[model samples]
Target: MAISSEPRLGASTNGDLVNRVQQLRLDGQLGAGKNSRGGGGALLPWVLCGLLAVTWAGVGVRSYKNAGQKADDTASAPQGTAPAASSTNTPQPAGPSAVAEGELVTQLKGNVIPSLQITVSPRDVAAEITEIFFAEGKRVKRGDKIATLLDHLYVNRLNTEVASVAAAEAQVTRAQASQTSVAAKVAKAKSALAAAEARGTRATAMQERAGKDFDQARQQRASGSIALLDYQRFDADKQAADADKIAATADIEAAKREVEAAEAEVKTAVASTKAATADLGAAKARCAEAQRLVENCVVTAPIDGTILTKSADKGALVSPNSFNVAAGICLIADLSKLEVEIDVPERQITRLKSGQSCKLQADADPTREYRGVVDRVMPIADDTKNVVKVRIRAYLKKGEQQGEFLKPKMSITATVYNTPFTFDPSKDLPWGDEATRK
Candidate 1:
């Protein structure tokens, strides 16, 4: 409707231009509307995209730094060596360590033994076992009695011998008195013989005087001057004196013989007395012997020791020299003193000596140990085993307490050290030097 001034659509030059402008305006309107809708939707999307881009950038930078650190560590490490093998290659040793060694040592202490043994038995008296008075292992003095035997018969014999001695003594006294009586008879006989001799001499003188008177009377008769009767009387008197003289002489001789006989009787009585005295002495000796035998029947203790074995019992018969039906009484031993016999190797024995120190360990008690000194060493070797037999007297150390478990005949081991040995540092040692050895 406004066609008056406007160029018409079909006008030559301006028509095309005006239609093109209208077409451009319509296209611009559509483009503006579409742009407005898109702008509103794209606001939230663009904000989300910006936050994502910043997060991705931060992740990439962290990854790059981690890779760089790994590369640096790889370059710094040692090459061609495993970590486990490197530590294991160093050398280490194992075992118990050694302490100080190579000290000067003397003979190893050990046990020894007695070379000979002696058994004692009773003599002179019969032995009987009664009560055991001593314990085993105790000490005793000599001459102590150990047992006794019955002696009733010996006692009776002693009494009989004593009576015999008394009887013999009485016989000696009676014989002495008889000897004195015989001596007195001999003295009286000698005095009577002397008086008879004097009488014989007087009778012989009277007989000679009467004979002379008779001859003178005969002469007077011849001369017829004297009486015949007087002469006859004188002759008779001479005859009688002759006869008396002869008798007196014979009586003197007989008295002399009697004196000799009495002297002989006295000598016989003295001999009898001497014989009686000798018999008394013999009887007394017999009595003493019997008494000694009786006393020997009572036996006592021989030593203060315990009995190890009983060989006889009560009422068993025993002999002085032999055991007879019974075994030889009891055996006893002293236990206060102890000894051990050991056979050491010949090589080991050369290094041992008396009075050396020793350490002993009994197999039965491994934890317990004992200390002893060597009291003796044997010079000879054992013939059977070809080993050196040694005897050791072991005395417990003073003030040491022994356990009850210790006993005789227990097996034991001992350690002996060499004497006069030195530690040489220059030489390689089986055991190391002082600091390294045990």
Candidate 2:
């Protein structure tokens, strides 16, 4: 029989086999004679075919092993995480019973935020930060000191005002003393005037008695019953009484003038006292204002919360004009009150409603899922992005710390169900599934 050279297995396989056989014949491995029809020479094609089969078998085995290794690698490697991952080893929890078939479920990206965040800044006063009592992430209560500003200027102002108040009070006291002295003088003058009037009355009475005696003497002298010397003596007595009465009248006028002057002095003193009191009042007002400014220099927390960030450090200059982060001392927030802020497209805004249930997964910790509800859907929309902002009130599941995983400003993925779910802020059951409590 003649050996056919037809390529059966493949072009390359047949060519390789043929080339190997030719080379073997040239090398005298099969037989030395070309026309030699020995058993070895006749078995060459069968041996080559057997060798080819064996090579193909090894190749097939290697390929199978490689394919199996790839499959195993694919099966063992980690896969991409879903939007909301399961908190436990089990799969993600199912949506609430409120969700119906083919309901519009909207997926959104948002950031975690505190419901009440306060930016602490100095008001009205411009001063350099001297000390910081609290650091970032520190918890504090209302009225707790957070920072202190340099108060030397304010202290100096307060001291000046205090001194002014003291001076004003002293002035008021002096005026009061002067007023008392003048009032006493007025009383003394009044007493003197009364005494003068009494003296005048006595003088008039004596003058009248003297006149009666003189007249009686004149009548006696005319009737030849009195002597000339006695009459002259009576007239002298009347003249002396008249002079005494005139002097008494002059004394009374002097007393009246003195009383009037004293009263005027008293009025002047009262006016001075009133002015001094006004000055004291104004000084006190200034002092109180200065004290308030001094107290303001020490910044304190307005509410019970944790410090989010420290915008200004010690020795930094700050003022009310430098608002926001530029002059702010720190950011304080109530970590217990948390929310998620998302922007939904205008077309999808209709699908979102208040009180709708939502599932949240923070990018930082994708393994845990949080529960929340749509608290508000902003009525306004952004013209540039054509999206409306939405806020979802959220809370940590049971056994989780307030700010451990869901922190302010943390990026997260949120899934909102169109159906509304009953939510109670006091309970922790709705935050996690009953089967897999997180």
Candidate 3:
């Protein structure tokens, strides 16, 4: 029988392909041998047909392997992660979930952020930077000193205020001392007034006795029973006694006036003391204010956090409030309070709420995933983007970090696996069909 020299697609099975190829080689050799030099065209066709047959066999084998490879790729391809038409990356499945089968998830782009990022500034506007206490990126606790500004002026003001307070206190002491002296003068004045009163009483008694003696002498003189000289002498004694009584009365008045003057001095001293005490209090208050301002010059971390940046250096002027500052002293944030800000479509805003579980993947590190929870769902919508902001708190545990990867402002994605599910005991019935289990 003559061997046909034509390529056939279905004529040979894979089991016979090798044998067919061998037979084609033999046939081509026999045909070439039978044909003469002028019959080159006839042998050329068989040789070409044999080559085509071999090529086709190899192609079939390659197709079979390719088919297996495609099947494997399809099997391994995870659910919900289909090759996107516009995307270069075919996103893979995230971490394990507590969610059961058939649960839906919402994926969104987001950025990692610190819960609080505040720029630390000096309370004094004109404060000159003196020293930086902490290096950038160092963690500091609340009340920890981060930097120091020039506090010499405030310190000086405090000193002046303290001196004023001390001076006022000295004045108060002087006033009190004056009050003590006045009190002594008042006591002395009372003693002098008592002495004056005793002297006046003694003078009054002597004057009465002298007046009676003069009256008796005058009566004797009128009766010519005594000499005129004796009567004259008695009159002189009475006049002298009257002068002594008058002098004692004048001394008593003087003593009374002294008492009044001493009492008045005591009043003046008391008023002085009260006024000085008030001045002291006011001075002390000013000193406290100066001290507070001086303390303000020393910049410190207001919260527990790592220093994010430092814009002020030694000798730089710092201020708490300014229309523009080259930058504040520094900015620090609590890294442990790291979260992600996701922009969810306004249409899908209802799909999320607080306490919903989520999966977070950083763009910098995609292979590793971190768990998170929907910390907040902003009710307000951004009209420009038609999106609502959602804040997710990362499930970073306490003590030590599993991985120190999350950082503020890092681009990331949040796969919100927030669908709620409850396992049905009936669905878990053993070795039973769905209808039977129910």
Candidate 4:
């Protein structure tokens, strides 16, 4: 299969050789020669040689024709035209300056996503869905009602808690009233004790005066100056005063005991009031919890966003326990702020960085190009895919609004650039520095 560079006969020479080989076959010269050689095999070699020569001649003619045509084409080509690539030679890569302007540094495939997504579900309790206010694709604001759950149970519990709180409050009031009554009783007992002490003092003074009087009277009787009746009267008055003193002492002791009893009752009442207040506080806490649960029955949007999906329907039972397994009432997302999540090959991850500019094109709408910036490079890598997760924040062009075209979970391709791309007014295309283009 070697190609000889030596001058070869053209098509005419090839035609003549073909004619000669045909004439020899027709004239029986091939057979005559075979007989003289005593075998047909000897003649076979000559025939084969002739056929090979004719093939080479035809190939040479074709090569010549191709060469002439190439020459003519070269002559007609405009000046400065690049030469055709040589199959034998490897192509040299473009130099940094030779690269086209605005060429992407790297391209990655990913999915469009919302900047924030939330799942709306019951907080802790399970309930049957009673109503849904928002539909898929509907725009909602923060605190807007999204759905309602069966709240009879919560309402009942709240009522019970309220009653318990009221009861606790009544108990506290009664204990406080009892405390006041006991305190008053204590005061009364103290007053009685004070009165009994005053009477005892009076009785002591009377007893002293009476004893003195009896002694004076006895002296008079001894002197025979006073009558015996007078002496006896004085003695009788002394005994009465002594008996009054003893009675006053007993009354004072009894009043002191009553004061002690009353003070003890006051302490007991104070303890009861404190216990009742604690119960009231506990009841109030329960009441507050019940109120919260009741409010939670009316599910609300957590942020201003669009409803992406509705997983729960009316009458469907939902619970926090099965939340991991079951979907929520609806999926909400902020469509105004979108992002692209890409798993860049580990080899290309080094070139990616936060704040780098990017261009995004959704598979569903490749004609439109969305602007984006590298938002983050996840610290962790995917072990199975040997890739690093990268996030890009997508933005609409000036005068463009976030529409339904770009949606969450849409497949998208992102072209990352080393620098921000600037629009070239004249070219109507993006442009960048030579380094960036390279």
Provide the clashing-pair count of each candidate structure.
21, 0, 0, 0
The predicted structure with the larger lDDT, 3 or 4, is 4
User: Using TM-score as the measure, what is the rank order of every candidate, best first?
Assistant: 4, 2, 3, 1
lDDT of 2 by residue, 1-438 (tens): 987878556568667767777776532653456546554565666788798899999999999999897675454222331233336766643432233533546777899889899999877688999998998888999999888999999999999999999999999999999999999999999999999999999999999999999999999999989989999999999999999999999999999999999999999999999999999999999999999999999899999999999888988898877544366888999887788999886655766777778888999878888778788988799999878999988867766666776788899888877666555546553433424421
Every candidate's CA RMSD: 39.3, 19.7, 21.0, 14.3
Best by TM-score: 4
Better of 1 and 3 by TM-score: 3
Q: Name the candidate that leads on lDDT.
A: 2
Which residue pairs collide, candidate 2? Answer: none
After superposition on all CA atoms, how large is the RMSD of candidate 2? 19.7
Q: What's the TM for model 1?
A: 0.46
Q: How well is each residue in 178-197 modelled by candidate 4, as lDDT tens digits?
A: 99999999999999999999
Error (Å) of candidate 4 at residue 73 is 38
Error of 3 at 391 (Å): 2.9
lDDT of 1 by residue, 1-438 (tens): 444866656678545644654454433545667666665533544565567669989999999999897775454222332222224668643431221233222222233222222233334556454443344443344456655666767788999999999999999999999999999999999988988988888878877877787778778878988877876787788889889899999989999999999999998999999999999999999998888877767554454444445555556666646634553556654433445566665544555555554455667766766554344667788778666866554444334332233445566555433232233334212222235422
